[model samples]
Target: MASDTDIGSPERPTRPGRWRWLPGSRLGRLIIVLNLVGLTILISGALVLNELRRGLVNARIDSLTTQGELLATIIDQAATVGEPEPMMDGAYAAEILQLLSNPRSQRARLFDAEGRLIADSYWVSDRVEWRTLPPARTRGDGPGLDLNLSGGSEDDPDSADAAKAQAALRAEVNTALRGVHWAGLRVGVDGERVVSVSIPIQHVKAVLGVLTLEARDVDEIIAAERAALLPFILIAVAVSLMSSLLLNRLVAHPVRRLARAADRVRLARARAISVPDISRRDDELGDLSRSLEDMTHALSERIDAIERFAADVAHEIRNPLTSLRSAVETLGLVEEPAARDRLMAVLQNDVQRLDRLVTDISNASRLDAELSREAPTPVDLRRLISDVVSLYQATARLGEPAVTFTAPEGLETVMVSGQEGALGQVLRNLIDNARSFSAPDGVVRVALGRQKGQALIMVDDDGPGIPPENLENIFERFYTSRPKGTAFGGNSGLGLSIARQIILAHDGTVRAENRRRDTSTEGDAPEAAGDIAGARFTVILPEARR
Candidate 1:
């Protein structure tokens, strides 16, 4: 079971793990997205081109099969001879093969029923097969190659390749002789890839020969498809590079500059962080930069204030210590009883002063901690002021000033948002200061009311008003300027200062001003044109919203 404050507190963010490196920074994420976009396009193009290549290969095989079937049928009808056991006429089939035109990229071959070659489209059409020959071997190129000089013999590489090609052709022809059509990819005699289709020539269930058609332009088609994909690859690469450069300029560099500025502050090279260029931007980074600058500035001010406070404490404590030392030394030197008694009285007064100063200093030092530790809540000013005045009335002595409280007519309470205890301490300090300065038999008035949108509490006393120039300085630490006839060493001067500090912590203001009265009438005294009546201390706090 957690309290509301604990439940609402934000948890600390966890650091990223080592394996999650891809999304570590803004630039890294941007680069991933940009590169992925290019990769997606390149992959899609490759997939489409692969499908096109498959389709082209299938279409080429089908076209060859159709052409081969028609030619086989024509040859079966025109060139088959003999009764019942019909056989192909090789001479006539050769003539028919020569008469029919084939595509330049395609070749047609014919074989007899005994698996013997009868005609070839390339030879019948007199189509010359052109190929680049390897360079002739020089006599000095190798040491032992000259022993086997014969070319195109049974032991030659070309002879072995030709024999292998003939065997594969016979195998294809043998399958067609069984009256089955075979169509697929195979290596041609020149070791180039081709789509080949074999069809059997038949005359009324009598097998005669086989005709095979091959398309040898598959490699060229695939090369063209690869060339078409080059432009997509280049575009994708260009997009990725441009995106990387843009991200570095827009996001990476500025963030780097901010990091450097923070390092400078941490290293004590600068008192406060200031990056005007980044701060001027209208974005979250800009807000962050400005916030850093403000935080540093505030911390610097607080450090300076603490230094000043330390110096002040040392100076204030020295005075009482000096007096006490002097009094102690004089009491031991005096011989007569009356003189020794006077020295003893001086010693006691110095001791009391030191005690008062120490106590006030301790409270002043703890003021900041107390204010920070306590949270603010709505406080009824009427009840707080009434309680303070009642406490003073209960402890009043003979001939002392009386404490009184007043609120706005018809208003039961005036509310402000502040720490109740701290606010009560502020009211008590103001009331005590007023009572100390008040004239004998005079009343110290504590008034609470609302003005505009603020809750105003004013403490007034019927005594000699403060000097106009010393009004602001009165709230400064250790600034005590009591009037004549006031008891000596009775005030520590930290009361008003502490009050002002508490009011400021609550986002309120406290100020001292003299109450004046105008006596500019015909019967009035001429010297009393404007008389200072009393000193008024007003504390203004923002009204708590309903």
Candidate 2:
């Protein structure tokens, strides 16, 4: 039960809650998707690099553990003393740890069974840790005046950090003293990340001390891995930028142009839309451009037709009004009885003509809306024509022309796709037109047949044929040209025009042609040679598919 406006207007429903926050424009959405794609790639690279970092850490731990175990075995054999309960010779273990440690990459430390730090490889190798001193305070005399030159000041931040590392190292040594080997990541004495391994120094099933090895280059290795992931991030960013630009140029901008063109049409700034560049593209947008242009063109043409129809109606109505006014004025002046009677007749005729013109104008104006409102279905031309001809014959007077119908042999029905009421009106209009032109006692033939996949309906009359020049003009609104002795104003001239309009709306054609007879045989009359018999109105409608 939708109204005409509801049916004709395009839908613009509100967006659902979940999608309401999303960008409404195509370019905005494209940018979001492209950036997300790049971010996904960057995240995937980070995940892969994370796995690599774990593998490197585990490998470093395993390498340090192997070295620590070997050093612990050597220290147990070479630096152990005492009888059944073995004791670690601190001095001897320190000498052995110094000879075996590689101070450039690793630091070796030894803790006693009491979990006390003993031999330190950094002190034994005399490796100096270099650092840049901070700027001197304004209260000091020189740049190094307030610097904490003492390595283990209680108030120093480095001292507090080193204390935490020492406590963690003590825990690892205690665990090793229990005869368990440990290797994993931990904080070094210098407050830097390192991979450390602790192995027990045992002799003859007696726990002596713990030997620990730490690799302080673990942070450097992770930094290098992160640096290697930079190229993938750059590539993903570049691709996202390129995709956004391409989409804006190829899709977003063209769609914006189409919208602007439509706006021009809606605002009445332009009669029709014509975007040649967009229409040339071989895509859906191109199709849309072409369709818009066609629709606007059709609307413009319809406006022009309506304007012309209004002007024609005004002109036709004015003529009758002028005549009626003149007749009324003259009737008042006329004195003779015959003159008064003639004036009365003229007034009546003018009134009748005006009424007929108004009725025809009303019908013509509503023709478009009626045709559009009624949906088309299969219509049998044969039955429709027969019914119209029968009605004319049933109402015929003795002096009127006889109406006859004929169809092709073996043709049961001539079916077409059209509104039954509209098509029936078309038949009625054509028959009435033909009867109006026919002479009394003459025959008007209504023929229906199928030709070339079309249902053909021809109405032929045995009257004066239409002039060749006016054949097309006869279908124009308010055009009437009657022969001699015909009653003036009896025909409103809208029947043929309305009939043609109806047929055109049904995707059919109607035309007036002169029906000619050939007298080329050996006849006695040569003056009747090639004579024009009468006017034939032919209607061709596409046949309905079975």
Query: What is the C-alpha lDDT profile of model 1 across 1-546, one tens digit per residue?
Result: 122211222343334443344442444455666677768777787867674677788899889998998999899889988986788899999899888899988988888787766777777666665655545767776532111111112112333554455556567778898999988877655666778888999898878888989888988877777789778777877777677666766666566666667666766778788989889989887898898889889888888888998999899888878888887887778899999888887777777878888998898899999888878889998988888789889999999999998886898988889888888999888888988998778989989888899999999998898997899999999899988887767788899999999999989999999887775677765545568888999999999999
Against the hidden reference, what TM-scores do the models get?
Answer: 0.60, 0.65
For each of the candidates, the C-alpha root-mean-square deviation to the true structure, in angstroms, is 10.8, 8.7
Q: How close is candidate 2 to the true structure, as a TM-score?
A: 0.65
Candidate 1, residue 241: the lDDT equals 68
Clashes of each: 0, 0
Candidate 2 per-residue C-alpha lDDT over 93-168 given as tens digits, one digit per residue, 9 for 90 to 100: 8888888847478878788887766777777666676655433456644333122111222113334665577667
User: Which regions in candidate 2 have their CA more than 4 angstroms from the true location?
Assistant: 1-229, 235-239, 246-270, 274-287, 373-406, 409-415, 440-444, 522-530, 544-546
Note the residue pairs that clash in candidate 1.
none
